[model samples]
Target: MLSKKIKKLLNRQVNAEFYASNIYLQMCAWAEAEGLDGAAEFFRGHSLEEREHMDKIFNYMAECGAPVTIEEIPKPPSEYDNLMEVLKAAFKHEKKVTAMIKQIAKTAFEKEDYTTFNFIEWFIAEQHEEEVLFGKVLGKAEMLGFTGEPGQTLHIMDSYLKRLAAAH
Candidate 1:
């Protein structure tokens, strides 16, 4: 059984994941509108991944005998100045998610909720990968100066993103 505090935190995390998925979806739409097909595909795939993450937490909570509270998700912004801006926003959001996961893990440990703590271990590792993945992409975007425009640089970066998405 999950402690009330832990259950509440898990529910919050589930909502956060949902919000992240929507944000990614919005980014995908922006990328598509800008004609960055590769980036659009990548964001679209990531949006689904984020939904999976939310579902995983929801299932875990249910398995632990805690019924999740479904809450309202705020609308995500649809406008982005450019692809670089979109990547930067995504990287920033990932960092925020990583912090939230760490906080949940820390609270679980402090409360001696080993089951919850153990359950969160996978999320810890996932957040690490998420941050690293976003950071790597952001770094490459910075290096390439990807401006969401039609040019050789955009093609190169788009191809790179397509390959990156495929590799995962």
Candidate 2:
């Protein structure tokens, strides 16, 4: 059973995750409009993954006998200056997610909710992978230089997105 406070927090997280999905979807749209098809596809896929993450928590809440309440998701930003700017924003967002997950884990530990803590372990691992993946992309963008040929950048991003899509 989850404590009432924890249950509320988890439900809030569910909404936050939904917001994340929407945010990524908006970014994907912006990428497509900017002619970065690979980035668009990548963000589109990521939005799906975010929905899965939200569902995971929602399911957990239900299984634990807690009521899951979903709130409205806020609108996400629709425009970005360039691919690099969008990617940097993505990296920052992932970092924020990692921090949020850690805070949840800390709370679970403090409350002696071993089951919840264990459950959150999966998210911790997931966030680590997310961070690493975004970090690698950021590193590549840096190497390629933000001012590089847009076509070359798109090709490279397409290759990476293909790999990620295949992995999924």
Candidate 3:
């Protein structure tokens, strides 16, 4: 059983995960429109992963005997100046999510909710991977300046996305 406060917080987290999915999908659309097919595919895959994250939390809530409620997700930006800009935004978003997870973990610890704390350990590990992945993308984009052939960048991005897709 979850305390009322923790339950409410978990519900909010569930909604945030949904919002994350929506935002990534929006990014994918923008990337597709801008002719960055590789980036677009990468974001599309990310959107699917985000949905899985949301379901994970939702299922956890149900398992804990807490009612899961979803809220409306806000619209995400439909365009970016370049691939680097998009990757940078992704890194920032992941950092923010990491902070949110930390807050939840802290609260769980304060309340002595060991089960919730243990559950959140997965997120903590996930955030590290998320940050590193985005950081690498950003780094690659930086190394390959805007003046380079767009096709090459697209190929590189596609390769990364393909690797990710093959993982699951």
Candidate 4:
């Protein structure tokens, strides 16, 4: 059984995941509109992954007999200055999520909720991976020389992202 505080935290995390999904979806739309197909696809896949993350927590709450409340997600920005900007935003969001997950893990430890702590361990590791992936993508984009102009360099970056998405 999850303690009341842990249950509340889990519910908040569920909403956060959903919000992250929407943010990615918005970024995908922006990429698509700018004809950055690879970036669009990458963001779309990440959006789906965020939904999976939310579902994982929801299912865990169900298994633990904790009722969850689904809250309305705020609208995410639909416009980005460039691909680099989008990647930077995503990397920042991932960092925020990592902090939140770490806080939950700390709370679980403090409360002696070993079961929840074990479950959240997966998220802690996942957040690390998420941060690394976004950071790598952002670094690669910078190395590709994104000048916010529609040109060969940008096209190459988009193609690279498509390949990355395919492997993902």
Q: In terms of TM-score, which candidate is strongest?
A: 4
Lowest lDDT 10-residue stretch of candidate 4: 141-150
Tens digits of per-residue lDDT, candidate 4, 92-162, equal 99999999899899999999999999999999999998888887887786787776567887888889889
Q: Write the per-residue lDDT of candidate 3 for residues 1-168, one digit (tens) a residue.
A: 788878887888888888889888988888888776767878898889889988998999999889987777788887677666677787888888888888888889999999999999899999899988888776666676633245776567656655665563
State how far residue 60 of model 3 sits from its true place (Å): 0.7
Report lDDT (CA) for all predictions.
0.89, 0.83, 0.81, 0.91
Tens digits of per-residue lDDT for model 1 on 1-168?
788888889999999999999999999898888788888889999999999999999999989889988899999989877777788899999999999999999999999998888989999999999889988887787788777666887788877878888887
Off by over 4 Å in 3: 146-168
TM-score of candidate 4 versus the correct structure, residues matched by position? 0.96
- Ranking by lDDT, best first? 4, 1, 2, 3
The ten-residue window of minimal lDDT in model 2 covers: 145-154
lDDT of 1 at 36: 80
Q: Identify the runs in model 4 with alpha carbons over 4 angstroms from their true place.
A: none
Residue 63, model 3, lDDT: 95
How high a TM-score does candidate 3 get? 0.88
Q: How high is the lDDT of residue 63 in model 1?
A: 90
Report per-prediction Cα RMSD to one decimal.
1.2, 1.7, 2.2, 1.0
For candidate 1, the 10 contiguous residues with the lowest summed lDDT are 141-150
- The model with the greater TM-score, 2 or 4, is 4
lDDT of 4: 0.91
